[model samples]
Target: MNRLVKTALLAGAAWTALSGVALAQNAQPASQEQEATSLGEVVVTARRRAEALQDVPVAVTAVTAQQLENRGSADITELARSTPSLTLNSARGSNSTLISFIRGVGQQDPLWGFDPGVGLYIDDVYVARPQAAVLDIFDVERIEVLRGPQGTLYGRNTIGGAIKYVTRRIGDEPSMQVQGAYGSYDQIDVLANVSAPVSDTLGVSVGIARYLRNGYGTNLTTGNDHYNKDVTAARASVEWTPSDSLFFRVAADWVQDDSNARHGHREFAPILDSAYDTRAGAGDDNHVETRGISLTGEWAVSDTLTLKSITAYRDGTTRGNIDFDNLAGPILDIPAMYDDDQFSQEFQALFEGDNWSGVAGVFYMDATASGAFDTVVGLANLTTLTAGSVDTKSWSVFGDFTYDFTDQLSVSVGGRYTSDEKTGTVFRQQYLGIRSPTFGNAAATLLGSPRTNYTRTREFEEFTPRASVSYKITPDLTTYASWGRGFKSGGFDMRGDAVLYPNTVDGYDPETVETIELGLKGTLFDRFSFATAVFDSSYEDQQITTQYPAGATVASVVDNVGSSSIRGWEFEGSLRATDNLVINGMLSYIDAEFDEFLAYIPTGPLNSTCPTAVGCFVDVSSARNFQNTPEWTGAISATWTHWFADGSEIAFTPSAAYRGAYQQFETPAPLLDQESYWMYDASVVWTGADDRLTIGFHGKNLSDERYKTGGYSFPGALTGDSLIAFYGAPRTFTARVGYKF
Candidate 1:
């Protein structure tokens, strides 16, 4: 074994032994136990079956309710900052633009066919849209973060692993908790959770949370409010347990976000803009409404077999402006209204015998998103162009099985065959600077179809695969290697060329990743545990989008070309420093490149007077880096809890993180550079009598680092060079409180 692996093994063994001894007296944190910070076992279902974190052979990280609360973590973006082999970001202060990458492979585009690189599951139900996965944590049991490509199980999108938010179930006891907080920028949060038994056969629980914040940036031009973010959401669930072998739960959730939206992060200069910005602007009006219902059924068929089924439906509608401009109000136009409806269904049969365990299941998901949006093309006069509806569907059958041939050896294999179909039609495609004869005809002769755009993609399939093996050589340590393949479906890019060119162009084929990982998982010291892994992933058929010239207008579309690869390492561990002190940390590094890529020249010198400009773009660059992906990410946190002689409880957490630089475009111009920066966070918590009352002080962005987040720009066919970029957020803080009964 390598020296690093040997050292890691030795440390893990020592920590486990030490932790066990201290658990007898110390109150340390445990994720699966009923108590807080107590050395207890944590149960996880990432492998399609329940297993202890220590016993599971895969690389995984989990945070319990206590840890999350102590860290003051409430959203997926924050959760990503605390985990290894994970990278998270939001563009324009909207969860709709969430980007998550694992081992340096991820999808950042919000398009019809391109799926999210990471899978987000709440209570075992897959979330449909990226926006729906906001993941507000309340009454949560634990959050399991599985790293690597999980193409073998848990359905599709599992390529970059998955995040499972396990919530508190309806138990036999009645419980209640209420919390409220107020902080800088007029930020306010209120939350409540209550649980009760309806009868001997039924149990019910309800949770509600409200978050509000006033504008943080002052607009110098229009005196408008900017940086205003708010959300109000609630959830209710009912559990039914009639027999010893069967259990069922039904849940409903709703969320409404109301805030005056300003322009997204705008760029003042190249390589100088961060993604998060608090700029003041005019035309501040943006809002969203989302609601969903889900039902889950679990049955223990026998001591060795179990069955699970999950079904859900969700709806969302949004209005107001999406992009804010620095130019005239012409740059400040509102998007046509848009609504989204999605449905998901899944079933799995799992078996766990003495030497064999596996799960088999089928999953189906579909979403239809239709929105109205306007585009600008004139130089002196502002023209508003409109676009209309889009839809898509996907389904798959997947399974995985593992068997132990002996006490020290085990092997597992898994795969999924997924099929996807998508279609869309533009009702009122506007040619901002030109005249149009027709808009709805996808087949209009390049001469008459100017009013509408029609595009359709159908019947695409992906076959993802997974394999792994593990061996326990000693009582305290185990080593393993895994191989998995991930897939991302290809579809239309709505923002590419704008309305002139319809989407009828062929959407690119799906992309794939072949990842191989090796790692060790162990516990030692009676007080510590650790996991480390190294991976190499090869990617193929990368996607690219560009503007296509059609007569007097520009129509943008997407296509796939070339290949690439990436290599990375990840390690994480936790220590019970003392009876009252806990320390945990994670680190990751990725080296990514374009082994092969096709970059099309987006624009060329054109007549400045023409309202519509287009050039015959050519593939000028090959094998280029992808967009919005960084190479390294790491985080560390320490939490210390203490009890007063008078019986009051107090806890504190200090945490920090850093993300390495990466390129903004597949073939970046001289103006673009990779992002490299770090951030810090900390929280202080107090517990009152019988843990009924609690007050907490929390602060985020302690580092106050300035960075750029999303979007890209290139030279236009017209006179102006395409200068598109957004600024990231600056350091901010807030204080919060909660009560329990």
Candidate 2:
């Protein structure tokens, strides 16, 4: 059978198995209860059953809708800002796909074969492809960010971590809300949501959001400033309850985004010399279009059993000329890079009562993509390359069970056996064959090879398991411990133009993480709550995919020799000092390094002439701390609200963060030591119209800290030559209006 057909068959088989399991679950026994309070000891579906967060014994952080809005975080990147134990990395720039690292592990390459280390799920359905994840969060019930390797329970995208955006489902209500905001940098955002019942057994909800912003940097050439973006999204859902025992809901969404970059840089001067590089110039645009639909069903066959099924599909396209340099560096131009990922997935399982529950199901996913690239030097073309298609299929069977030894003590265990098949073919007709470049001959070679043709296929079967134990020592306190395995798949590197090494197919090795962690979750004085955890994780065969040489078209890959471990501690607490005074804070620290890293310079241009190549592979025999990982990162926030004798209220919230400096590349000199930065953000709100409306004025970055929040250096481009960093957004003011009925 053809590879694609085989992949499809396996995927279908997994889903079919899940469907049968769900059917069986519908025929078992169940549990029903009234919804719990927002900040109480709520249960998490991540474990395949409803268990209190403190009772799960896993490293997880949950954020509510109110908190998200208060922080003005609309998308994944923004969400990562406040999320502890997490950091965001990018290959292209600001608008590029996000690579999230939890406990310092993740993939940073934006290639056809490399998938994100972190997984994003909506409801119980997995959003299988990365491109489809570009959509923003509009109306959400809550967001749960799970750290550590979730291999056993969450499966595939959970190799590093998992992010579940649980949207607000149809509740017992009829309501409507509208909100709008205008901000500095010529920003505007509008949102509206409406929910109602069509019949006693049916209901529907609809939401829409529009966002736009003008450039924050000047377009040296167009004089027509850019770097601004505009996005519009719409979501609608229909829910039906045929009887007290059955429920079904389906949702669909659409989004389109268009934006450009104000590619700027610091030359000898930031004013007169606009360092205009065509590749980084304003004529280029980065854009994406997305469409997604999903369906969910719930059936209570008996008082003791409940069955659930979740299915989702997404189709998307991304096109952009991601500029490498800001006219201030040697990074080359990446023009017309195109990508598309079509995803389809389904999950099914059964649930028993809260005291004892077991869930068994299968997961399947298929992702395919193709891309093109045009590399030029100073508007004059150097190489025109094309990359072929890549197809990936992943399937797994997973099960989780929890047994309550007593009302206060229980143990839960889950495991997943996964099989992954990947196939890719990159052809470079002329590009790969060029030896001595004669302008005419090189162009001819490039056209012939188009690019070097590389076809690779790899398959892996892995078993990951997790077990946890929790105990309620007291009514207000709970403590637990857990351990699990997580893994990232291996893939071939992207070789667009005729790279320095035509045979350099630095295939990655799957990174493995084994975590042992303990934590405490407690509520004190009836007005304060906190959770603290300390963990040690060992990473084997670490895949370093972000270390591309400066000016190189592809990222450099390396594997750890001995083994690496990361140990860290995290503590978060919130105090309601009074009815009108509240304070919250979080602190995190991590220590990560290579037990041993046997580095070697392959026979390539990178090892041929840097500082005479005297110490080409010198570090291979030693151990060193991992580069680019901050040792300490945390934040503190406080907000207070006061009411006058009248019907109006005002509030103030201030936030701050601290991050330790780190070097990007493992270089002796020319290091990019990203200095630590501290920032403050605050907002004030006023309400009127008998509490039906609210108007607010807010200013983020109250102290316009001019610092680089993120960055990386490419090795192929030469150390420090193409080093780039994303500067923190400048302080801005915003005004908002909202109404509810």
Candidate 3:
């Protein structure tokens, strides 16, 4: 840890020295002067309306296409490393199923009934399922990440924040772009986009991308590798403009993934082996498919008012088999599959008045989720299968109104009333004879029913509200404070089997959060832009999943854990150090803890809370913190672009990110605590004389830092070695070339 800090400090000093020298040499502009003096303004739609980043009161970071390309970012996980107060995680080694954490709130399990704390959207269309949320970046204009509660504007399950991916529109001129990259671990990526106008009133756009990489590690027992990636995606869109006041667009996309399951290292093995070695004897045959379509229409009713509508539908599926034990013989194996679909419609009216500006919207969504997984033990032909399905219908009415009393002072208020109805059925069965007589009556005693089937229906509703006030101290500076509420719907715990105490199909209660935030935004020296925010949030009825004792065994169930709170601050900025140099920095600090929490934990190296010799259930409330909550995280980067007298240019960018150590679970287990780590990345690009062709070299994790992102475990009474962990990727390098015409 000390070494990393020293390296970062040295790099900062070196950059500072270089900046001074560069500024002295380029004091007088040889090229354009306007571009050399001030940083470009960043525009965002954080408030459901287009506004300058400095003018909006919310804490947001807008990542441009050039910034993404410079970092060689392919997915949300890579992009998150460069942002403040945000983290991305993947469960069971499947990138298609993502987990996002913002301000200590997120869903760890991508199950059928659970809801995500953060909202995800593509061009204002919400994505309802985590199975389809891991979208690849292609032909995107920008990505906006809004921190803190956004339930009033985004509606439902936005207790943490929201992420928006906005794609570029089809232009009138014919254009094409092609890019390809090759890197370590036999990785290959390709992307192509083309747009053309068919006539004066119609235009079309198309994009395709393919990413392939070999596994980073090999299985010693089966001679097969894991963590490989094989994915492909395609998108098409059409735009129509029949009149000057009316516009419409329709788009469709398809994606497919065929990769191996996530691999893990044995925690209590006899031999201390290499970190990447695996002993699983069976193959992790994983596959996923996704398809979606959207239609958007807009009409200008008047000069100050406009109406917009969006309709969308999406379907996705995932299938995989995993060797949970990670042993040569595979004592425990899991085969899983899931399928989901969703349809949604939304309408909005935007109004701009002399003293007031606001937006009103109505939204409707219907979704279905289903999945099943089997537990196969040893060479026994016996299998315990758990299957379930859920159907959900949701509706909401939301509005936001802002009134300006003066040119320098304004206040805004908003609220959303949302309701959801959900129904589901669970079925549990053993294909053959029960493995043990002790496990035969799994559900009979707990639910007073046979281990056959159970049906349940539930309804949840909430009214979330928001209010804020801002004062423009100066034309270039703004200060604001806001208060808001967020809510997540109730759902059943599908992991409960016959051996569990909560075997009945009872739904959990909804969780809610209230937050207060203070912020400042301004421009300095006409060359630097900065934003800062301090916030506090209180959480109630936080949903938690844990093991519950039935008789002689334990079953997994979901329940309302307890209350919690979090306070944090963040600052982000960009500086035009020189005519051709730009420097950016982001820093964050958070203090998050559970005010009250009680749960059962497996007796292992990371926990010492079991009450009995065989690991008995006990309350572990006052001994731990929230899962995956890091105290401090931030990133810094510098870019230098120098244009030659002949108009060609070369650029170099160096970036680094740091994350403080934090607990991976709500336990006192040392194995679940990840240590602090740092990652370094850099890129160099050169543009051709015609400015139509480009080439670049990039490297990620240049220091080869190895860290654990997630893990799995069993009770000490169930297995001799109960814990295993998954590690992040190692150092990788890539070279790329691109052409635009």
| TM-scores for the candidates | 0.86, 0.85, 0.90
Per-residue lDDT for 180-282 in model 2, tens only? 9899988899999999888898999999999888766665555544446578888899999999999999998888777664343432212233222222452
lDDT of 3 at 145: 90
Highest lDDT model number: 3
RMSD vs true structure, all candidates = 6.0, 10.1, 6.3
Residue 515 of model 3: what lDDT? 82
Taking all chains together, the TM-score of candidate 1 against the true structure is 0.86
Q: Return the lDDT, model 1, position 473.
A: 62
* Candidate 2 ranges with C-alpha deviation above 4 Å: 1-39, 89-91, 132-137, 262-279, 328-331, 378-381, 384-386, 429-451, 496-506, 546-562, 603-628, 644-648, 664-672, 687-691, 709-721
- Cα-lDDT of candidate 2: 0.64
- Clash statistics: count for each candidate: 46, 35, 6
Model 1 Cα lDDT, one tens digit per residue, 1-741: 343454355445544544454355443444331133222256777787887665566678888887788777767667767777676676433543466766666666543334677887777777655654566776689888887777667655666777788888877988888888787778788899999998998999999988877665644445665666678889899999999999999999888777665455445432223343433333456677878899999999899889999999988876655443443344333343557788998899998889999999998888887665554333422233445455778888998898999988989888899888877554444443322222222332232344555566556788888888988766556678777887776666554443343333444677777877777666554456667777777777766655433333344556666677676677777777776777777777667777655544344556553223543334344546656566778888888878788778788889888877776556564444546788888899888857777788888888777666654453443312334454554566767777777
* lDDT of residue 366 for candidate 3: 95
Whole-structure CA lDDT of model 1: 0.66
Error of 2 at 600 (Å): 4.5
- Model 1 lowest lDDT segment of ten: 433-442
Deviation from native of the Cα of residue 350 in model 2, angstroms: 3.0
